[model samples]
Target: MDGHRCPGEDVTVSVLATVARFLARSAYEIPEKDLRIPLERITTAPPSGFVVSGFAVPPADRSAEDQHPA
Candidate 1:
């Protein structure tokens, strides 16, 4: 067994699945240096969303002409 099963386990699994899906579709790896975790605040509450900061914008998709560079 991975660990003791707890209440709201389904919700936890769902959130992790969503994050995994997003990571799978993303091309770049999310660096730890850019993360800002609020360690001062701790709560045993549901829907505790996280905030991400200091990320660079991804490059724009190039058109066929731009790719070939005539």
Candidate 2:
């Protein structure tokens, strides 16, 4: 057998590869690679006042202490 999911085969990477190939040919394009999200980013907070995406530096104040560049 060509390692296909005939009936009760587990849905492992092998089966996915075969299906992906078929879809790519049918769609007239190579299958797009999986874009894995960065796991470390998931637990972290996003930037302030910039919508929820990733951490960002807070806006600087006009005080003397804030005058120092990081």
Candidate 3:
């Protein structure tokens, strides 16, 4: 129903937020050659898919507080 929230909404939101945060803090590079997207397609997406290289999560960016909450 429109008035009621889906039971899985909270979990889905949490998972998405966690993933977004992880991605935001991660260091990665997308090659310029891989930036091509086909606008003619109904779903405009990269032909080779979104590719990234040298992906890493810097230890400095992650603090002990983030790993252990008080």
Candidate 4:
């Protein structure tokens, strides 16, 4: 039994499935790196919600970097 498995349970596998499983297993331990894809850049103004009788700009999460400027 693989060490990752629950105790007393046996897993079935085929040859190709075994190779695929090994690659997938190693991938789990690799650290993920953050990337700035263009789609990730949110350059658009976020839709404003109703505030102060639906007139004023809504309050935002100020601590966050993606806040819209007044």
**Leading candidate by lDDT:** 3
Q: Mind sharing the TM-score for model 2?
A: 0.23
Candidate 1: tens digits of C-alpha lDDT, residues 1-70: 5879888989999999977765555465433553345666675322334445554333442343468786
**Per-candidate total of colliding backbone pairs:** 0, 1, 0, 0
Q: Residue by residue across 1-70, what tens digits does model 4's lDDT show?
A: 4468754444444656765654444323323343334445476332342222222222333323365555
TM-scores of all candidate predictions against the true structure: 0.35, 0.23, 0.60, 0.19
Candidate 2 Cα misplacement greater than 4 A, ranges: 1-11, 28-70
lDDT of 3 by residue, 12-62 (tens): 999999889888988999877666777788788777777789998868556
Instruction: Tell me the spans in candidate 1 whose CA falls farther than 4 Å from its real position.
Output: 1-4, 30-70
Best by TM-score: 3
Candidate 4 — number of clashing residue pairs? 0
RMSD of 3: 4.5
In candidate 1, what residue range of length 10 has the lowest lDDT sum? 55-64
By lDDT rank, best first, the candidates go 3, 1, 2, 4
Query: On a 0 to 100 scale, what is the lDDT of residue 52 in model 2?
Result: 26
Candidate 2 residue 12 Cα shift, in angstroms, is 0.7
Q: Candidate 4: misplaced stretches above 4 Å?
A: 1-13, 27-70
